[model samples]
Target: MDLAIVILNWNGKSWLEKFLPNVIEHSDESVIYVIDNASTDDSISFIETNFPNVSIVQNKTNFGFAGGYNEGLKNIQHEFYCLLNSDVEVTENWITPVAILFKHDSNIAAIQPKILDYNKKTHFEFAGAGGGLIDNLGFPYCRGRVFENIEKDNGQYNDETEIFWASGCCFFVRSKDFWTQNGFDARFFAHQEEIDLCWRLKNSNKKIFYTGKSTVYHVGGGTLNKQSPQKTFLNIRNNFSMILKNSPISTLLWLLPFRLVLDAFAGIYFGYQNGISHFWAVIRAHFSFYKQIPETIKLRQKSQISKFYQEKWLVFKNFL
Candidate 1:
């Protein structure tokens, strides 16, 4: 098959029941696989019983998003791999545009479809709006989202464009290119690993694109709630590691510290607005990042290449 749609599942049987039909309906020409991350629930049985034609790859243990997909992808070999989230309801004919993009340009390594909120259909989703973009200091934003601000889908980003990264929510990556970067960082466990992978691809002069021709409705925060402290911790810690693992040492010298300061302000703001647990989650995330610095820097030394950051100071210009 030209494309394989792989959804990573971790006790998300309800999501599968709700959204898998959309994926199967839209991707009749492509193979579909549910890669289970050792769910204690009956997710595997549900898939086997309900969608017998769909393939399954069961992990021995829960590996979170990064390790789970890394392990699951080893079993399938296709020209393109769509790492779709279980909670995403793909629109009709969603996969064709991305496949055409890959076929048209060999250099385009990855692409994301236009993502709108499933609950709030008129607005862009937070995970990936039009496409993923980053600031000079390695902070990520999107064409339709910056911080907590999600833009209304007024066809503002309808044009297909080259992007810095594609959301893991329903991201499409060339299978060979994915293996070239060694897949997602297993150490990331979950969160921000897609950015790191895209950064590596970008460093090697590979293009990532956002195509509005295809669209998907994402029920964001399915596994982890938006306000969950654990989610906050993972996002904060993993983002720091992503910057360190992919950025130049020269940039990291000042940029890392500046990010820390900015993140500190973020922690304070979260504390002011929410509560101490949210603030402490940020503190805990920084500590976790500090502890992993030596190992993450090693990853940086190995993967750091010349190309990075097409845009700069996006946080200040757009959000701040």
Candidate 2:
């Protein structure tokens, strides 16, 4: 098969049972594979017995999202790969538009479909609404989502266009380009790794795109609850590492410190809204980022782009 639809699963038997059929029915032409991150539950057995057609790549231990996919995908060879989330419900003809887009341009390395919320259906999903974009300070947001504000689907983002990154929830990418970037930064473990990979791809002159023609509904926070302090920590820490690895040195000098100040304020807000745990998460994230700086700097490519953001001071523009 030219396309491999790979789902990374870690003790998500319920999600697989709920959404796998929809995926199989709509994606007939593509091969389906479940990369099990050493799930302890009966997930592997259930897939083996009920969905014998679906292939399974079992890892010895849970490597989280980034490393799990990186290890799992090394065995599955195809022209293209769709790194789908287990909780997403894909619609009919979802793969065709992305395939057509990829064929139209060899430089187009990645593409994301319109991701809607599974519960509301009318609103764009939080994970990746319309498409992903970054600010001057390397804060990632979607066209339909800015901070806590989510815009309802009004056909405003129903056109195909270039995007800064594709959602990892339903990411489509050329296999060659994926491997060329050496897959995702396993150091990320999870959260914002897709954006980091897309940034690296952009630095190498590859395009990231989005098509509203295809659609998928995501049940956000399937594995990690949105309120989890761990999620906050991963998001903040991974984002810092991503920016440091991809941003031009000249921009990093000022942008990094400015972001740190903004995050301090954000941490206080999160503490008031969520809990003291979130405030501590932001602190932990910064310390982790500091510790990872040597490793992150070593991973930097030969070139870094200056004009990577779609907007300047998006936080101020959105909230102020």
Candidate 3:
């Protein structure tokens, strides 16, 4: 099958230079695409000078992760689409194993290769370890990771399994499935967008799988550095929106009061400590997303929400 590998980058020149050859060699004959989020650095010019064969999408402003990739997804001319980071390198066998799965089933909407730590080599990298998994609360996590905890890259989680979502850092989705979900929500600006997309696909009975046979070496959080407080804020705020925008009526109402109390306290605390403005902004964003809930509700299919929840045993993250 033809694969369109889309790498979203922002000032990732050095990392791309080192990993592009690996991607090119391993993903032979595949279309290599570099979507730059208008890095202040000369990333676009560098790509033109250094890797003339790769396709380039140069945005004038930094579009963050979702926007950069959404642009790439819209333009890809292939059956399969991969949203890989510029900081990742693939194994020689990477694409082979994952592609073979599509041969067996038409329902599999996406697949993520095992992600390993580039520096450690022997340990797992948490970014998108085995696709992506999350609790019902929109707290996006991974099968090999939970909360801030990340597992080692040992051969321990070497078996294939059904995944909640494919990692945004390095994962693939069927081109049609992606377009059907309208790709990642650009409002996400950065995090938790993958889970939202996957949940929508779940509504269509599409399976997102984790393929262990394929692997990629990743320097996790290379783009936005997920540890920054800005990153923290996005993760928290977006998690709230993801849950509000995607969860079914029963699920949302079930988690409402507690989610409300937590957000209320969180807003107050952040406001008191950070400032009233920051706190009020969070509350406003929350209400804004809540207001739009109806729009998403109308788009959902397979209201038997239990099908998605039952597999997880009715789990939701306690993190808020």
Number of the top-ranking candidate, with TM-score as the measure = 2
Worst 10 residues of 1 by lDDT: 303-312
In model 1, the runs with Cα more than 4 Å from the true position are 301-320
Could you tally the backbone clashes for each prediction?
1, 0, 4
RMSD of 1: 5.6
User: What would the per-residue lDDT of candidate 3 be over residues 1-320, giving only the tens digit for each residue?
Assistant: 88899888889888888888888888878899998888888778888998899999777677788877887566667889888888888888688878888878889998888888898887677788755776655467776677667787667767778888888777788898888878888877887788778888887789988888888888876766653456646766677666766676667777755776787788788777777666766677577657656764554555545566664554554333
TM-score of 3: 0.84
What candidate 2 gets wrong by more than 4 Å, as runs, is 305-320
| Predicted candidate 2 versus true structure: per-residue lDDT over 268-316, tens digit per residue | 9999999999999999999999999999988987765324332344655
Write candidate 1's Cα lDDT for 243-277 as tens digits: 88877766877988999999999999988887899
Report per-prediction Cα RMSD to one decimal. 5.6, 5.8, 5.8
TM for every model, in the order presented, reads 0.93, 0.94, 0.84
Which candidate do you rate higher for TM-score, 1 or 2? 2
Worst 10 residues of 3 by lDDT: 311-320
Tell me the whole-model lDDT of each prediction, alpha carbons only.
0.90, 0.93, 0.77
